[model samples]
Every structure is written in structure tokens, then in C-alpha cells.
Target chain A: MGKRLEGDGRGGVEQDLLRHDCSIGEILKQRGVSRRDFLRFCSAMTAAMALPASFAPRVAQALDQVKRPTLVWLEMQSCTGDTEALLRSANPTVAEIVLEILSVDYHETIMAAAGHQAEGALDKAIADFKGNYICVIEGSISTKDGGIYGTTGGKTHLERARQVCGGALATIAVGTCAAYGGIAAASPNPTGAVGVMEAVPGTTVINLPGCPVNADNLTATIVHYLVFGKIPALDSHGRPLFAYGKRIHDNCERRPHFDAGQYVEQWGDDGHRKGFCLYKMGCKGPATFHNCPSQRYNEKTSWPIAAGHPCAGCSEPHFWDTMSPMYKRLPNVPGFGIEQTADKIGLGLVVGAGAAFAVHGALNALRRDKEPNEDTREG
Target chain B: MSNQPKFKRYIWELPVRWCHWVNMACIVILSVSGFFIGNPVSFGSSASDFTMGWIRFIHFTAAYLFAVSVMSRVIWSFIGNKYSSWREFFPLMTDAGRKKTVRMLRYYLLIDKEVPETVGHNPLATAAYVVLFGIYSVMILTGFALYAQHAPQGSMHKALGFMYVLFSDQGMRLAHHISMWFIFGFVINHIYSAWLMDIKEHGGEISSMFSGYKFTVKKEE
Candidate 1:
């Protein structure tokens, strides 16, 4: 278990990372990515980074120069959805080989080591790498009931995270659970779940806040870090500015449909199959931010909106509690009048209630004797 | 015995009336503009965008007017009619005013079918108006908060920073949208109260708000 350098984390994950020891040009020879395709990808990444065309050369040089970054992917209290989303992606296998050697130090599902051996190997990588590795954390940070919600080797996840992220170059929070406490921390989160930023405030936390973030977003963000020697400029939410800089409504594929007032009002309607905008279906795209519309999930196969499911806005914090009734436009305002939401209801209640109060106040105002006006009183 | 007529006099000054009417105009514009912004129905409408650019133009113009009105109101609080003064805006904080408020509520509830009259504003209406102004001030605070977002790191931003925190960016939006409905509610209640009071008193109390006169009967002694 003294597998310090070439990790035993991903079971045979180091093999996947090492399998592509050949240069990208050579790898492309096998995968069939042409010179044009590679350049196009480089240019897209540069633009996504918000750099001018001139930066394309630098991006090309950096990508060509750096070997894929060494990665220590950690899975905490989460379903393996993030892993599934990445590995089970459509045919183009670029995502599978993003890391030159996926030195997965302690991925529970994929790692080959058992119990003490896996735990021992994890410590070895931390000691060996010191400060030269990317730590990608998936899922939420559970701290409930003394961190008993999810434990690895008798150590709470909070304990494991602090150990892994102690001196990492940069930390990538891979999913909503890791980025903003997805459903696990929805409401009355018993696990004391939190995103990495809340978990480690001092570290440079690059949040890819999605239920399952776009694989390309994670790749570009990592590659941008590799090429530029720093994380990309981030928005207030600590999300990479390149991906979360614009609202989904600002560039949605269904944007034209929203502008045209073409909405699929009900399920099983013609508009639904015809693929109208999901705004009316409670698409959180207007309020929520992410790069799904542009990035296109599953190697450009489709996304939630494209596949006819309204986005639940898993990226936004407390989304389940905040943006629930996922198919409604207005979130229920707390301490507000209830009979006041649907159109005409608030108006009716207002008129009726106002009239009743008015009649009563007027009757009291009547049958009164004239008294000294306060304004007219002698000083 | 001798008989003579006495002047009832004006409780509100010219500037006060001007501020009030101007505020009314601004609120009307603000409500219409804000509503169009809220529900921008563009089906079968002429220009293709559901954003209602024209209404937004009017809305912002009214916002400027509203800003002026607020500035004037702040000044009026310091220097205006005694009845309109900051102290007079609230009922006496004395124990008597507290008792009067309870009495007024009970009176309205017909717990005692007797009417109580006092000078200026009754305790109940005075307290309600104070709350009314408080909400208006909040609307102003939130409106400026939205304006600051276009450029968020300067004097204007810092000046209104408290509002940004009071209602964060999202809350600012919710307040702005819902404030219009609050104004609509105020308008409905305001009109009914004024008309009903006018008919009950037979003093043309509602028209007097516009004509600035009230005829009062004086008995000779």
C-alpha cells in the first residue's frame, strides 16, 4: 500500500491515466480527432475562458506543454452519479482520458485496495504530493450526528476532506452537493452538509455547481488551470466566470421560444413534443446560472431542457427548499398572504377586504362632535 | 348675544399639497410601469419583445420623479406644516394615545357603538400612515438597490449597501415586484375610505382634499 506516486486510488484508474502516455497527436491518431478538431476545441476553450483570439496560441502552447494534471478524485457522501455522468458519457471518450494518470487516491467504488490498504495508500499520496496535485471532491460534506452519516475507515467525511485538502494546489468541487449542498442538504439537512467553500473557506474553491456539472466544464476549468497556472476568474459564487458568467436564459437553446411566448403549458401537449421553452414548466434557467445550454451534456447528446425535463436548478443553493414546486414561476414568499398568488385572487381578496374595512371605519368616523383641530390650536 | 363666522383653515401647506399630488402622480406611473415589467405579455402585440421597453422607459422616468419626491419629503419632515412634522406624523407616544388607539379599534369593531373624535389624525389612521410611509421608504431603498447592481462598487453602492443586505439581490427583485401590488392595495383602500367618509360626513370631505376647503357650522353664543 506504499503506492505513493502512481496511485492505487481508481483501482486501475492509474492505468486509464497512464494508458494515454502517448502525446495527444498520437492519441488523436487512434481516436480520429483531426488537426482542425483539436484547434477548434482549443479555440472554444480559449473563448470560454473569455480571452481574445490572440490568447489561442498561448492556450495551445500550454495545453500541448503540460502533461495532464495529476488528479486525486474523492467521493464523499454521494451517489456515484457524478462518476456515472463522467464515465457513462456518449461514445467520444475524451472525458475518460482527461487526466494523463487519474491517480485516484481513495475513490471508494473504483479503487482496488481493501480497507487498511486503501486507507494507507491515500495517506501515502498526500505525503508524497505535498502541494502539487488537483483534488476533485464529489458530493456533500456531511457533519451531522457527529459525522456518522457517512464515514470512511472510522473517519468522518469532514475528517477525510481536511486531510485530503490540507495543501492541495487547487480544489474543484465537482457537483451541486459539493458546490452548494445538493438534495442531501436541502431542508432540515440532518447531515450538516455544506459545499467545499463552506468546508474550507481559505482554499481557492472553484465551484462547478450543478447536480451533475457538465463534464466539459470540469475539463475546461481544469485545463484552464493547467494552462494558465491559476484558476479562471470566478463570479461571486466562486463559480468559474467562464461557465457561470451568464444566465441560462441569456443563451438557452429554447430562448427564442420563450421570447416568442411559445410555452408547453401541460405535459402530453403538442408543444411539449414540439420542444417549446420550459420557462412555464418551472425552468429555473432564468434565475439559476450554469453552462449546460452551451456546454451540452453527455458529449453534446442533450441536456435537461433539451430532453424535455424542466431544470430543477440543482446548482443554486438550497434549491430544493428555495425553488421547489419545480414547475412554478414564483417561489412561495414567506409570511405573505396565501390567497394572493394566482392571478385575480389577490385582487378579489383586496377589494372585498378593503370594502369591508372601509364601511366599518366610515361608520365610526360618523356621529362625531366637532373638536379642536390640532393644527389650528394656539401655540 | 352675537354671532360670527370662523375660518376652519388649511391643515396642509401649499408645498405639502404639491408634494402629495406629485407623489400621487409618480406612484401611478410607477405602478403601471412596474406591472408591465412584471407581466410583459407580447402575444399578438405589435413589437416582438415581451420586455415592454416603452413601459420601462416610463418606469425609470417615474423612478427619477419618485426620487425627487422622496428628497422633498425628507426636507418637509424637517421644515413643513406642524401637522406634517416628524413628531406629528406619529401619535403622542403618551399613555393617552395608547388608550385612544385601543378605544378607536374597539369603536370600529362596534364594541361600544360610540364615536371618538380628536384633532388632526386619529390614533388609528396616524399609526397606519406611519407604516404606509415606512413601506414606501423600503420601496425606495430596494429600487436603488437594483440600480446599484449595474455598477456595484462605488459611492452609490456603498450608500445603499445596507439595503442590498436587507434584501439581497434576489430579495430586492421580490420586493420590487411585490411593492407594486402593495401600492395597488393602498389605492383600492384609499379610494373607498375617502368616498365613504365623504358621504357619511356630508362635508364633501373627499372633494375638499382637491378643493382645499371644508364648510363647518358655527353656533352663536
Candidate 2:
């Protein structure tokens, strides 16, 4: 099926661009992106993918030969934070180049079409690229009351998600909302929001799940697909294993402080000023998984923990429910209310047991003292 | 009935007793260190304190000891006497055993005054032991699964990677954390039950765990 997108060998760079059927490399060349810059991006992507340095050239070669794939981006029940983060990618110029090569046929938030025109564009894109376009969902699907909670273009978000994901080559859930319902599905989820995969079963959905997913990860995922003609290797959560494989704590800049038993006891404390570990400040880095450390946001400028804040484990599944309160360890034990921690519950049980033991022991001692020969009786 | 005097009978073997105490120590260390590892308490300000690191090291060490002791105990269950045998731990396998378990439960509830005498663990205790072992198996399985995430990709990964199918890392962590509490409750109940039985039976049940022998009145089979 991918062969249909291949270009004819008899074409010059200009001809390839005119036909809109050239490899990414030819398109880059046409766009005046030098070969060196393209290769440098490929090398960077290779490193991000955790491939050996020796594979950089191979990555460049693969990327240079791939056709511009069609993409349809759908916005659902979300704040559009992922789109904002994507715009703020480390290399916006490179991001634009990559987005151009992908030929995003229809994107609701960024497209110029309005009302019926936009709906027509979506229908046309789905028809033209049927079974070939990549479906990028940026938000969760609201399935409550037949998806009345979120509607766009006269169709509910759940209906649109199922429709778009149905005929796409691959479905990419681009943020925590689209991946695992994020804040939209947190406790008291009256809207009944669900992730893309849950909204559309029987399809492989690649989850790039950050609160606002790291642009580098989204770029790498698309690049991996463009280069390899398949989804990148995913973890159990359907996230790219290379990006989410290691714990954030393992690579945090303040790891030395963690190992040294130094921590910021309170906000803006001396330890905090000195960049001690944020473990005491309710950092979820120990449990979170992401490449935010090495692949810092905003062009490697800084991330949450790097900026003297603790990680909220935004990249993990169920962050809203599991990693909340932002300043505490352990999820609140259910049925015990928010004030009770696992430690508190456990200690309470231990204490209760001790109390019961004392009372039971005292009762047993009194019984034994009353009847010294009672123990000698047998049936 | 003209009764015979009580006599001491060898029951628990030396290896079984060793496994019990070592496993107990390991569990205590594992629980304390595991809690610390889960929720680290900041100690010093030096960048090279290594307190959490040492805590983790100790936790891992204790975890290994706990797993090994349990493994060795399982192996010994087969070779040990009837009292220490694997079958004794699974009293539900026999109808008679099931009946005794009910009777033991009734005795504990004060519905029955006369308790059925058993040389080793009462059927109720045996069933509880069986469940405890099941919990141990789950803890070990999940513990190794998490450990294997960091292990090199050869034999260790090949052996434990399949565990990924059972639980997500977060789910596994939850299970591991919850299992620790189950064990903690079991230890409390176990000690209390042993003391209660020792007093009621006057057979030195608690002391037998250490001495490998129980002083019981000789009765006709």
C-alpha cells in the first residue's frame, strides 16, 4: 500500500515539488533547507530515538526517501494546550519544515476553512486519503450523553474520532487527554471523557501522553513513522518506549541531591535555592517517565523540575487521578478521603492491631487467673 | 479416662526454623526499607550523602533475602516431616481438613468451646498460611518484574519480561505496596493467634516455633 505513494525516478526536484509526490529530502531541498541541516535534524532524531550514533546516516537516508504522508488533526474535548506546546517546539523552523513535509491536509484549530467549508475539507481529506492519512487526535473524546459534552462541525467529538480513526493509516493520540483522558476524565468526570483508544477500539493508537505532550516526542513519533512506515516501539501504555522507558528521576539534573539525601523541605527554602532534590516538595519524578530532562522543553531551555519546581508526572497515564496534589507522595487511599495517605492508613491499622492485642491479652490473662486448672481440661 | 503425662514431640525441623526467623527478619527490613524507599525522608544536605542510595541498597538486599528464604522454605516443605510438609499448609485439599477448618473458625468465634487438637497448624492456620504463601508469590513475582526492568536484556529479561503482560508498572507498584500491608496484617494476626493457642492448649505452641518441638499431652490416635 505504501508503494502507491512512491515517486517516479524521472523527476527533478522542481518536478517532484510540482507533482507534490517527491521524497522529503527533495521537498526539503526545494524549500531551501540545506542537506546538512536536514541530516543534522535526522541525527538529532536518531539520538532521541535512542538508536546508536552509527544509525544516524541510515536515519537520514530513510527520511530523505519517504513521501509526504497525509495527516488529519482532530481537536476534541481539550484545552488545545498540545497545539500551543507544538508551536513552542525547540526548533520551530524545523518543526514547520517537518509539518510541511507531512502535508497536514486538515487541522481544525489551524486550518483557514470555516464552518461548512471546514467540514467539507475534512470530508474531502478523509475521502481522498482514506486508509492512508495519519489521524492525530489532540484531545480526549467526550462520550457522555452520546458525546453532547463536546461537539464540532455539527458532529460529536466521539463520533468524529471514531470516524477519522476508522480509515486512518495510523492513529496518534498526541496528549494525555487524547491518550488517557487527562484532567477531563479526572474524578467527577460528568462529561464522561475517554481517550482516543477507548473511544475507538480495535485500532492501534500510539499515545504520546504528557499534560501538554513534549513537542520533541510528538515530532520523533511522526518522524519514526515517516522513516520506518510503522509505529515506533511502544510501552504497555502505547507510548514510545525510548522516550518513556526511563524514570524521570533517573536523569533529573538534581539526581545528585536526591542520592545525597538533600531535599527542598519547603518552597524557596535554602535547599530549593541550592537546587537540592525536589523529592520532599512532592516531585513525581521518581514515578514519572519522560525524556523531559535530556529533551528539555522550549528548545532545551528548561523543564518544570529544572526551573525549581517538582514534576507532576504529567506524561504518565491517569496523572490527574494518580499524581495530583502536586506536593505529596502516594495517591490518596480511596475510601479514606483525601486527608489519609497510605502511610497514615497503614500506621493506623498497625496501631489498631496493637490496641486490640493489648485488650485481648488482658482479657486472656484475667480468664487464666480465674481458672488455673481450666487449661488442663480436654474433650 | 486415665491420662498419660504430656511429652515433647519433635515437629519443626532446624532448617524450617532457620527459614522462619530469617524470613521474619527479612520481612521486617524489607517493610521498613521499602517504606523509606517509597517515601524518602531527607536527611543531610551534602550532595554525596547516599542515604537514599543506602536505603535502596538495603531494601534490595532484604528483598533478595526474603525471596530466597521463601524459596528455600518451599523446597524444604517437600522434604520436611508431615507437620512441616507442603500438604499441611494446604488443608483445604482434604474433606476432613475442611471440616477441621470450620471447627477451628467456630472455636475462634466462641461458638464452639472445645477446639479440635492438631499436632501442627490447625486447619484454619493452614488455610491462612496457604493464602500468605500466595501473597508471597505475588510480591516476589512483581518485585522481580520491576527489578527486571533495570536488568540487562539476556536471561533475566527473558525470564521476567513476560510479567509485563500481567500488570503495568504503576499497577504492579500498587500491588506491591498493597501486598506489604497484607503481610503486615498477617504477621499481627499470626502472632496473636499463636499466643492465644499456646495459652488455650497449654502445649507450648509459640515456643515450639523456636524449639522445633511441642509439649502436648499424649493422646490415643
Number of clashes in model 2? 1
| lDDT value, candidate 1, whole model | 0.67
Which candidate leads the pack in TM-score?
Answer: 2
- Model 2 lDDT, residue B8, Cα: 80
lDDT of 2 by residue, A1-379 (tens): 1111122222122332353478888877766777777877887788888788898888888878888887888999889999888765667556656565676666777665577766776777788778988889998889988999999988899889888899998899998999999889988888998999899998879999987888778878888887777888887678898788777888889998888788888888888899999987778886777889998887678899989999998887777777766787656666878677676777778778878877876765554222223343332
Scored by DockQ, the top model is 2
The candidate maximizing lDDT is 2
lDDT (tens digit, per residue) of candidate 2 on B63-179: 888889999999998988888888888777899677778777866765565645567877788788889999999999988777765532446656887776676555566678878
Please write out the lDDT profile of model 1 over residues A145-238, one tens digit for every residue.
Answer: 7677878798988887887887788889988899888888877888899888887778768888887877778878876876878888876678
Per-residue alpha-carbon lDDT of candidate 1 for residues B10-80, written as tens digits (9 for 90 to 100): 55666666777888999988887676555544342222454444565778788888888867876887897
Please tell me what DockQ candidate 1 reaches.
Answer: 0.21
